[model samples]
Target: MSDEKESVVGASLISEDRNGVRTLTLHRPQRKNAIDRALWVALRDALDAAGHDPAVRVLVITGAGGAFCSGADIAEPDPTHPVDKMRRLTDVALLLHELPIPTIAKVNGVAVGAGWNLALGCDLVVATPESRFSQIFARRGLSVDLGGSWLLPKLVGLQQAKRLALLTEMIDAEQARALNLVTWVVPESEVDEFVLELAARLVAGPPVALAQTKALLNEGADRTLRDALASEARAQAVNFATADAAEAFAAFAEKRDPEFTGRWSVSGRAVPL
Candidate 1:
């Protein structure tokens, strides 16, 4: 019950930390939670902070007022050059992709263009059954950005990815799940509770192992089988060095659920990146 809610950057984004889960809500309901530059900075910084904070084990991103992000906010004037603006977006994408702790996207409604990629960047995406998703980049006469080109092809295969990005066809959450784009498709009314329960389960697991598993999965597609095996072995070695591993064994022996403290420090300190 030590949850605390904080405003990270203006009312556009709301941050809530409960138990071991940090939920970042896109709050621009008027704009269907469209992401502006300020929201992007807030989200990137929030992800970085959560990754470094030992108290945080899972991060969830969702939109307020029943809608996930519609896309990038086009209403604002951009003083920066187009290249600089895109570079900034790229940085945010990379930061979200590389965050150590697990991230979940709770897509309650529409997620289009960069917004769709935002949800894709997360380790898991739980969406409402009626939620709509689209690349929507081609429709706007713009190619995909926010790592969509990279993430889509991997998730849905090259041809399906091309179909989605090229046609910009809107798909329901169920279709997204079938396409391997969404992990779960819950009813809109139950999405929040379902995501909260899921986050709790994730946070209750060994943090080091979860992080390592996430890293392995993310890099698995790009690595040779041999390289992946070596990486997995190294990760297991690190896991064995943690008190959490010992506790897991002891709990198993005692026939009790393990109480994971999630303090996988190296020599009584944080792991070096």
Candidate 2:
């Protein structure tokens, strides 16, 4: 796709598309990109749109100016009930986690509370050396939301998760990386280019197979070994039915790069790769 850009939801969010990658930027730098109710709604809609868009092979989440996100905007007053307000966060988290395309969190600065969990929800996280992270909910008299309760322990183990959540200590990029919370720590100057190249690599991959691999790994943790193997077998059977799989073999024999279309071999139907 040609490069395209637009500011949406009263400019609280910016959506930019380049090649097959869509980058969603949290735009409230004045407030450290905090998710006010409007931004929360905008983000949910943006994620939903990207998930259904065939042209979007990869999704990147980042923030404008400096901070990634400061979590929900508790400072902003709203008449909406507490439970209803929280449902907004739930929608964004579930949509992000269930996205078929590969996702990358480009953490430019502080990612705190639900903001940190938002980054964690992505498949990969690329943070700058200067970036900081915290599960600051306890400090703010709030419990973890936005899947932090489930994702934190899985990433850093129960003890570490509790320590981070309870203590609310801010950590640097290297510290987060050591705990496997970040996939890579890059220089601020190089982070944008690095993520762009990373997204390009994912875009070039077979979309169908990558989605299956991601799903298998995400669900494998909760499944028995035998069940996991059965799922893998079923996934491979579906992969073989795609034109991309045949193209891969042909390209390997021809010593050429495979052009993946994510099309069905039998019906010629495409899966929006």
Candidate 3:
């Protein structure tokens, strides 16, 4: 881990890497960490870098202030054409979803509109008890964008997704959890510590297997039963070929804890997490 934190675009975003976990923080506290054009570009670049960085076993997204993202910064004028802006936003969302390593969204406060959808792009979402969420596009007189139309239904089912999008009602973290939009709802004071521990656990797991599992699950919903089964079998085969699989068997036979060295781009060897 580096001693200094890297600031992205004058601290509108920040990046820190520690113990195989790379955390990207939305840093616009004065604006409730809203997404401006610069911040979006910085986030996209960070995710792309993390995806290719073998040392990064997990990526965590959060906001720096007491609040998470409130949504897009509507006050800021976008110089870029609307079409190009949407394209960039789409690219960022896809980059986040397709990143090889696991991604977690740590929602500490309000996450509304595009901010909520951005959190949904992550593999897991943890929110504080006081965190509030809403799909507020309708209230803004704009239809849902940033892949919310696809992700919301997959998360909370079609009817509930409609209810949330249509009504644009704010829900507490507990309610979000009940609706399956949030993975866990913990106290605000413990969110950072809890996310750190969770990231450590994920980092300690077999990297190849974990990545394969994430890919499989992400694709499962769009595939037919037979297709999903075939994909699973193929993923299992790939996992079995990794050195970690043999290590696991050996440890099982010897009755000891198996140390997983998350092998990434390294050739002919495994390295410690």
- Which of the numbered candidates is closest to the native, going by highest TM-score? 2
Question: What TM-score would you give candidate 1 relative to the actual structure?
Answer: 0.94
Model 2 regions more than 4 Å off: 267-273
lDDT of 3 at 68: 81
Per-residue C-alpha lDDT of model 2 across residues 101-202, encoded as one tens digit per residue = 999999999999999999999999999998999999988899999999999999999999999999999999999999999999999999989999999999
Worst 10 residues of 2 by lDDT: 264-273
If scored against the real structure, what TM-score would every candidate get? 0.94, 0.95, 0.93
lDDT against the true structure, per candidate, is 0.87, 0.93, 0.88
lDDT for each residue of candidate 1 in 43-124, tens digit (9 for 90 to 100): 7777778878888889999898878999998777768788878877888899899888999999988999999999999989
- Return the number of clashes found in candidate 1: 0
Q: Which ten residues in a row have the lowest lDDT in candidate 1?
A: 264-273
Error of model 3, residue 249, in angstroms: 1.1
Of 1 and 2, the candidate ranking higher by TM-score: 2
Tell me each candidate's RMSD, in Å, in order.
Answer: 3.6, 3.1, 3.5
Order by TM-score, highest first: 2, 1, 3
lDDT of 3 by residue, 74-184 (tens): 889988998988987898899999998999999988999999999999999999988999999988888998899999999889999999999999999989999899999
Model 3 lDDT, full chain set: 0.88
